[model samples]
Target: MFDRATTFGEALEDPAARSILERYMPGIAASPMATQFRGGRLGQLVALVPALEDLAERERFFAALAEVGDGAPRPPYDPAIAPDPAYEPDDVARGSAPATLPGPTPLWEPLELRFAGPSHGNPFVDVELEAVFTRDSGQVRVGGFYDGDGVYVVRALADTEGPWSFQTRSTARSLDGITGTVEVVAARDGAHGPVQVDGFHFRHADGTRHRPLGTTAYAWTHQPEALQQQTLATLADAPFAKLRMCVFPKSYLYNADEPDDFPFVGSLAEGFDLTRFDPAHFRRLEQRVAELGALGIEADIILFHAYDRWGFADLGPAVDERYLRHVVRRLAGFANVWWSMANEYDLLWSKDIDDWERLAAVVGEEDPFGHLNSIHNCRPVYDYAKPWITHVSIQRVDVYRTAENTDQWREQWGKPVVIDECAYEGDIDQGWGNITGEEMVRRFWEGAVRGGYVGHGETYYPPALGLEGEVLWWSKGGVLHGTSPDRIRFLEQLQSEAPEGVWDPLPSDWDMPWGGAEGQVKVGYFGFNRPRFRNLILDDGGWRIEVIDTWGMTVETLPGVQRGQVRVELPGRQFMALRLTRLED
Candidate 1:
């Protein structure tokens, strides 16, 4: 019998134990690290690796070994971890709904039909449910998911205002052959529907310009209830329009606490049931997404990440597909949702490019709305030229050159470049987490002028902000203590005033980063290069000039309208920009 408490040399005699090592720590069978680890207790291998020191990681590693070894307890099923599904059938027939239920459902809002079906056996894996929603424009096929206790739901969105009908088809007898009708009405005011790629930029479904001023708070939802509420309250006033948040609770540096809930059934002390999902966890997520929408923010939801103490990141191909489909089925109807395939996806070493492509295909196939999709990178950037990729989500590959290459990447991919993880403004010990507030503000302006977007994060040590625990703004979504947000807000206001299609980088000197349309507007940002006076090449026309103090949030206009090829006076300060607006005669 294999034993984790015994030395790995003894455990290696059992082929099953060796196989477990090969599965998790690939290449370890022939690696030098194995030789060192093999001399110690098999369970002590985690201690050899400094990165796996956390309670969750330790529990996960030993549990894996125990699962394959002797006397392994059966997989756990905790009732508290599983909650009642969020569906209740009304006075309708068993497999059918009323022909017309309600009137004038808003455009792009979900129309849900719940049916009581077979709860026996694995309904999650056994049942297949789908419905075709037909309207005046066309018919869209939407997939439905199995909620617990025999409840199956078919949720669909109507883009046009008209009477829409839907009929369900399922493998289960009780779920199949259901029919219903909903009256689709005009979209509510400020309801822009989902964001879509518009050439090198983004726009809403109704063609409104959407420049993504995003920020990252990877595990905000997994925090305590009070902290989650605080995060929402902070976000309500912050200038960020999009949030890069993770679907799974993160397990990494400064993030060791057991989450209030998990996506799968079972506790961290016990392993999760891969076949089942925690519906309450998803319901909480939905409520958070809805709340974010109410505050006019887009949820750039990350589906996978490598900072996992749970085994969600290491799920097999079949289970991965099932999980992806399930998430898409539930959240696709939300107009504010954007699917980020993963955060630093390459860090998930178990997966390859092919695996990512298949998962992306599942999202495309399952989501009827066709929400924006992209994968973030840690080191090797994913080839964004793939047809399925809507835009490029990136973490700077090189330190010191964060958002400076925005224009180059935009040209290379012919897509919008979002620098989602340019080093954050913080006082932390890690280099990636401790850039100055001024530097963060500079990157924001630099990226904006180059026809790209940059994301913000904060990692100030908790005590520095006079708080108790590790509640950094980057991962935990606590209050922001950095000075970048106000400057970024100023930058956003300037961007909002500029006309559409204005911020594409124009030909300029290597030192100056500038962008504008030919005859409308031009903004030249002199980042760190504080020139007292500079000659600007402009079209021969009357122009109005304003010197902007990006840091101070002040705009000063010169004496009068200036003509072509003028030498403009500047403050000779860092984080200063010159704006030129063509004076229409």
Candidate 2:
């Protein structure tokens, strides 16, 4: 979705979306509220269309909404009611009076214990609190911090299921020496623990392969409520598995508007208190992170980025560590969180590699879960060789050959490769923000075959929405306009359909070919390369092949041959791929 906050009118920017909304609900697309819900992230505007109540019509509109933005729940097509002005973190529901510990604690889920202390001086600077839990498996100690409004909290994650005892210690009087006990229950369905690197691939702590089919909606959570809802709705339905976004609000290009909240307690005119935090803002982020987890999406949070007018981009090293510590204590407990140290880490003229190293150390020390971590780059890449960096979070070094370098990185870094930013599919004036959908989709295939991951982004400019220059999915969140997301979903489905082995970089005569089981099964994509056909010879013989048109979204299975060589005909077009598997005896 694109940012539609500052550049909205009565009607939705897209004619088709407006038409569908008008036809269904008659006047919703023209209402005063349409100024906001036209992909706004405020309260969700699910207009219940009485006319579209028929199952067929409803399905048609549902598909249309998904195509335009995100699919709605069974709809009357009415606008969703906005929540109260005061926002609280949306958390897991439990059945008790205190709402803190009314039930068995789920494994990998955050368990928070409240502590009250005398706030003598600067509570944020003075208080030091933590909870230690000892189990049959081992002993675990976690550091806690002071929450504003005279509150202090200690949080911990139970890694094992067994009898456990706990103790709390703090510099504050009442908070010190508190003790507790809790039982660790198995994780609920779809909740895999934190992500880890398993050799050349990524997996959950519980051993689930994590295919990071990612997208870069850099400030989706920073937009207004309606737009945020729209972004969530769009993601809830897309096949994307990971979302890369910034914790600090962006202030560049199409992302000039201020975010709804700031992570630190500060304002633009009057500077910020580096030691203190804006609780509501962090709570909102926590809520979004949880929602993403529910949708099977990893929250790849960029803790810092260079784009800023808000001084946040230039926090002193000590203050930066404080911000990192606060974020780790509050946000790292979630199962689907990934720590992206910074976006374009080199572009921040104020900081150096050593500064990033220091922040990474802070996150490393505080995040007990050891979630997947990396630093994205704009120029030279930060050393993934460093033990702290779990995987490679890369922005394209070269426009023409970005994702094709995946296997090379894997070989060089000996870790998982994520081409987090190859480019976007759009007609924008910027080179990075605009490319054909076909090229973007081709990068996805190229990355996948190389045993790595690809990232998605869209920057289609819709001037008709009066945005002439505002709102883009790459920065702000709004309706999806590019053609790459669906095709990438097809690629994901193909990856899931692999039978014998997982995809890997094949050392074949063709540089683009990727396969599983030492080339027993291969998938090759010819990106921007035109060849009518390729002549192939396999030692194993018995080969079944299929042609993949990444843009046309078609898969054509060809006849199998139990021979040494075969002539494969291609459309001689860009974004074309091939799938070959050895027939089993």
Candidate 3:
């Protein structure tokens, strides 16, 4: 029997309901398109699936569904968490503090000002709260967000070490006219602030090199507590410095489980309250961001994506604007956060180019720290030439060629090119999720040698391989069962030895992708091609050469220094590279 209010996901759980669905639309259960709507109402699926557009067919399916209905009670919504329309700001405390920011604030660390504001109407809609922090260097105006219960929080940071003063201005009378002073101090050791874009590369606010050796686990935060903890533990030891994760819970293949909490006040069954946020959810997410920061990993937070069972992917322009503003205000304070406007923006059919432009502008404007900003792609690439975009974030358009195009991308944009999603090292049914570990390591080296960075993902689903259920590392973020990560660590070690703390492509033959500071430190990679021996021209004397077996993780130093059209011996095997370090003169 079926519940009239049963969702596409709920129906799948009911044998009779699932059978009814299969009868009406054969193979709909296994359809990738249907899988995306597992959390959506049955009625909503008709609008998305073209086959149900017919009036007769739709009515017939509905009649059949009704015939099996037993009027099962739908899940009840908890009224305690719902916002009260009659609520108002408390009148207990009035007046501004001379120093709202705590004394002796660390540089580049955000300071907070909490205020009680009018809650008669939807503060999220009616209120506009911003604060200006001024110092001898300059001033920065940052937006604030409503954290429910009539509480508004404004956060700002001082880049320079000195005395800084701030004042608040808002639409509500209660929140306005607040003032503060902050005694900014030097940052502790190793606190390199937010990552900023340097021409064709990245460096921290303090000028420390940031090489983005990243990986993808898009919905890790939304997973269960135990799994999330395990993911964090795995990341602590992994070589990746950046994690590309999503703000919203995903609804796709191997990601159909319902999260305990959502960003909004309600659930898919009862309809979410778009105006109010779930504080617990945001708090948990913020905690995760801070945890990743502690582990020296940047959080590349993706705000939107097409994979949705809840209506988050299709939230109207107004809701979208409000949501973006709210998210930026809440997370911008963290130095580790990077604003990825969306992942696979083109695949989100509801948002057009104009919508994306407007949304991106909101993020760029709201973020006071101006962390790295970029949007990813599916098939069509966003124009990285746009002034707001700090760098290029790409998903490979061609199956056969991804990292190979890094040089062209770098030349075209003159910004750091990141091959964020070339492909995964997995054995899944989908082509995007199934590539060999050797191939994955090859892609990383390929991108690195061409002066671009690559990201890694795994999707191994071998039942006999000691995996816990169907938890795939690409989305669920459990134990990593891939061979590329260890190899990637070696690659990171090699790249870290660069004289400039990063590599730049040097002129070389078409067959070999070589990069580093010329006449100083250099690496030449042979991806799949194997040759018996290679000849190289060394400009200066005293160069030490080493043969690197990428897969075997071995580096053997050659006998002595070679110079001027030298013949370098090789193992004549695939996944090999050569490194040359000029001996100190």
lDDT of 1: 0.80
The worst-scoring run of ten residues by lDDT in candidate 2 lies at: 1-10
Candidate RMSDs in Å, in order, are: 7.3, 17.3, 7.8
Q: Candidate 1: give its CA RMSD in angstroms.
A: 7.3
Clashing pairs in 3: none
User: Which digits, one per residue and each the tens of the lDDT, describe model 3 over residues 403-447?
Assistant: 988888999988999889999999988999889999999999989
> What TM value does model 1 have?
0.84
Give TM-scores for every candidate, taking all chains together and pairing residue i with residue i: 0.84, 0.80, 0.84
Clashing pairs counted in every model = 0, 21, 0
- Candidate 2, residues 1-585, lDDT tens digits: the string is 211111123225556556766765565566766655443221112213345335476456546544554433332222322212212123412111121342577887877776544454566666666777788877777888766766666677657876667777555435556666778888888788877888877778888777888887888888889989999998887889999988888887877777656887878778777766888888899899989988999999999886778868656666777778888888766878899998887666456566778888999899876788899887767789999988999988887898778889999999989999998988879999888888888888878888888899988877944565577988776778878889988888888777522478887454456655564677877777878997877667577888888888899988756458778888888778888877865
Best by TM-score: 1
| Residue 160, model 3: Cα distance from true site in angstroms | 2.4
Clashing pairs in 1: none
| Candidate order, TM-score descending | 1, 3, 2
Q: Find the 10 residues in a row with the least total lDDT in model 3.
A: 77-86
Candidate 2, superposed: residue stretches over 4 Å from native: 1-102, 464-469, 499-501, 510-512
Q: How close is candidate 3 to the true structure, as a TM-score?
A: 0.84
